[model samples]
Target: MTTITSAQAYLVDIDVETVRTDAVQAFLKQETVFVSITTSDGLTGVGYSYTIGTGGRSVLQMLRDHLVPRLEGQDSSKIEAIWMDLFASTRATTVGAITSLALAAVDTALWDLKCQRAAAPLWKVAGGFRRDVPLYDTEGGWLHLSQDELVSGAIASRDAGWGGAKLKVGKASHREDLERLLAVREAVGDRFDIMVDANQSMTAAEAIRRAHSFEPVDLFWFEEPLPATDISGHERLARATTIPIAVGESMYSIAQFREYLERGAASIIQVDAARVGGITPWIKVAHLAESFNVAVCPHFLMELHVSLVAAVPNGRYVEHIPQLRSITRNEMAIKDGHALAPDTPGLGIEWDPDAIDDRRVA
Candidate 1:
């Protein structure tokens, strides 16, 4: 059995080209916490977790001071057991960002180590549903863009052969949001899907009213219109609107997803690997959503999600947001309208060691 010898963590800050804004906040930067684990057998595995613009230091410290020490001498192949140990050891920080994000770095690295040991790519090793999943563009549709910019962006996405485009909603005037959606719909025509994300900015009643107004444009999914805690609000909104209600990015616990799924509050499960703990729990959430016949279109880290989404039968779409370009060798490939799962062994991510070293913040 390969025994873990050491684990290390660091942080990198990736600057966004255009400041990404939505209803709640501006995504000024992406802070990724990278973790690498080495075993006695001389095998090394790397993994990472992210925050929008903060908390990278906290994730790094949690990994170094608390979680990494526990991994010493453990069997690297036992990913689930290791993940559970991390989950249990960090009980005080469980069901929140710091613990979950820290666990993600360790758990994902273990999975990578396991896959590398097997000499198989992550998609096939994970489950191998399909190599290609349809793509939806959110990069071009930030809420800060003008209506013309939004329409042009939708047109560009359609021209580039993406299946859908997501527009940020929750403007002060529902009329302004409606105008932008209508413009995009008119530009992209009836065939291409148009998804809308409100980023949990509205109350239940406002969300219901806005959902009804958006029906005329034929939205693909209504994402995070109400706060994640407002299960009853989401249920009310889901019942009032024909459009599917998608949720889960901000949710830090799997039990939170269960509440929404069992209650029919969220029709599309947008489980983010880092936020949900790691690939281990991420897959559990995917299967949980699958059992409910809900679509799993995960939130971020599309580099990793491409493989995870392709592994599960019910995974519907991969959000096309390339966040790790500055420190990674390959951007995930998109052909026709779908993102292709990488055939590279061990999580399909090739970190440029020098690039990562240059940007190290911790």
Candidate 2:
């Protein structure tokens, strides 16, 4: 029986090269928290979680003060049990970002250990549904970009063989948003997919109004138009428009996703592995979405999400928001409009220890 011998947590702050502005907020930096676990068999696994520009220290504290201590001497293979126990120990913070993020760091490390022990890549070990998932570029679609820049970026993504590009909506005027969408549509032509995300900046009535205006452009999906908590608003918007409502990135638990799925509020499930806890619960959420006949196009952290997307049958697209390049040794593999899952075992991320150490803040 391999037992966890040690568990440690660290924090790093990585800056975004380009300004990333959406409707709701500006992403200043990635406050990444990492957990490293060593087992009695001498196998070590690393897992990580992140916040856009805040809360990394809190997540790190949660790990150091509560979660990591409980991990020592536990059976390394009992990932679910460990996850539940840690979660229950932090019951006051359950179903929230801090607890979930801390659990993600530890839970993902356990998954890394599980994958290494089996001698298989995470995608294959997790489900083996597909090796490559279609790619969509959000890097070029930020709301801060000029209309011409947006058009050029869409065309550029198409030229590079990416399947789709997402545009940030929720501009000052509905007409302005429509104009930009129309311009990109006119430039990229009819075959390419174009998506729009409001970043949860609109109300139910406003979202329905904007969805009506956006219908002529043939958008692939409308993402996070209303706050994630507004399930009834999303339900009404979903019924009011032909465009599919996509959400789940802001969500923190499986039960939250179930509410959206059962109410027919979300058509595409964008489950972020870090935000939803870790690969354990992330996979559960994916299977749950599959049962509802919904496709998953998870939010950011492309390095991790690519494998998760490839591991599930219903994973439709991997959003391309390259945020990990500075701290990782390799870029995600992209070919012919798709992101390929790494064939290597143990989470599939080639983390640069030296770079991580240089950026360590905790």
Candidate 3:
């Protein structure tokens, strides 16, 4: 067997047709995280990780400065040790969107390498849990979207075959958010599943207040009502509202997610594979959430999450945000509405090398 060798980073602007904007923020530009890992025998595996708007530079810096040094000239097969090294090196930064963003890149690259070596898609290597996960269309739930726009988007999503759709909430006032949600509910009607993402904008009282207002609507779940750190707040919101409190897109590790689960903080768990270390940790999260009988609805990376959700029994929905269409060789397939996973080697995440050639940060 060949010993592990070198790792390098590349900064690419994955061209997207449009910037995905919502109450959270805007993409502003096309960007992605690309990593190359080479073994002693000359077998190189390519992996991918990405961020939406901010933190691209930080991801590159972390890899160029802190992470690559530890992995260079080491056995790539020793994944666990390398993961530990990276985790410890960045521990001082602690876990947040930033740390998790960096880990997402490295972990993704490593998984690509592993899949290439084993000659299997990520779903198989990670243990083929399922082939079909429930799908939800994220119809660009922008903060700027008017009530009419929100209703139209939801109906369009339903018409397109999506099982549900996520709408943005958390404006300046809880009452305002309710008015918008009610309009959307009236448009989409009672049969469709309507979820909401507050994007960490509300205080606990506001989250509770807004949640109660949506009770007549039969909401699918309430997402990111408050900061990920305030576990007690989330628990309070969960207990106070009949609506399910869903979190974990900003959370980075199993330990953190375990805390959410232990506290009964979330009824619907939205784990981001990129944010929660990588496929390894993401799978760990899915299983842990399953043990508690919590629903698993992974955040973003719909192309990646489709496969993951299919493999996990409790997996719920893969968010469908069609922003990576220009850069990816295979844009996630949408039939009616559910996003379909590609049956290809690795993650089925091959980008147009030439399209990324003109990528620019400035």
Judged by lDDT, which candidate is best? 2
Per-residue lDDT over 262-314 for candidate 1, one digit per residue giving the tens place of the 0 to 100 score: 99999999999999889999999999999999999999789999999999999
Compared with the true structure, model 2 gives a TM-score of 0.99
Q: Would you estimate the TM-scores of all the predictions?
A: 0.99, 0.99, 0.92
- Model 2, 1-362: lDDT tens per residue? 88999989999999997899999899999999999999999999999999999999999999999999999999989998999999999999888999999999998999999999999999999999999999999999999999999999999999999999999998999999999999999999999999999999999999999999999999999999999999999999999999998999999999999999999999999998999999999999999999999999999989988999999999999999988999999889999999999999889998999999999999
- What lDDT score belongs to each candidate, Candidate 1 first? 0.91, 0.95, 0.78
The positional error of residue 115 in candidate 3, measured at the CA in angstroms, is 1.8
How many pairs in model 1 have backbone atoms within 3 A of each other, for residues 3 or more apart or on separate chains, i.e. clashes? 0
Error of 1 at 175 (Å): 0.5
Q: Stretches of candidate 2 above 4 Å error?
A: none
Deviating ranges (above 4 Å) for candidate 3: 14-16, 360-362
What does the lDDT come to for candidate 1? Answer: 0.91
Candidate with more favorable, higher lDDT: 1 or 2: 2
Clash pairs, model 1 backbone:
none
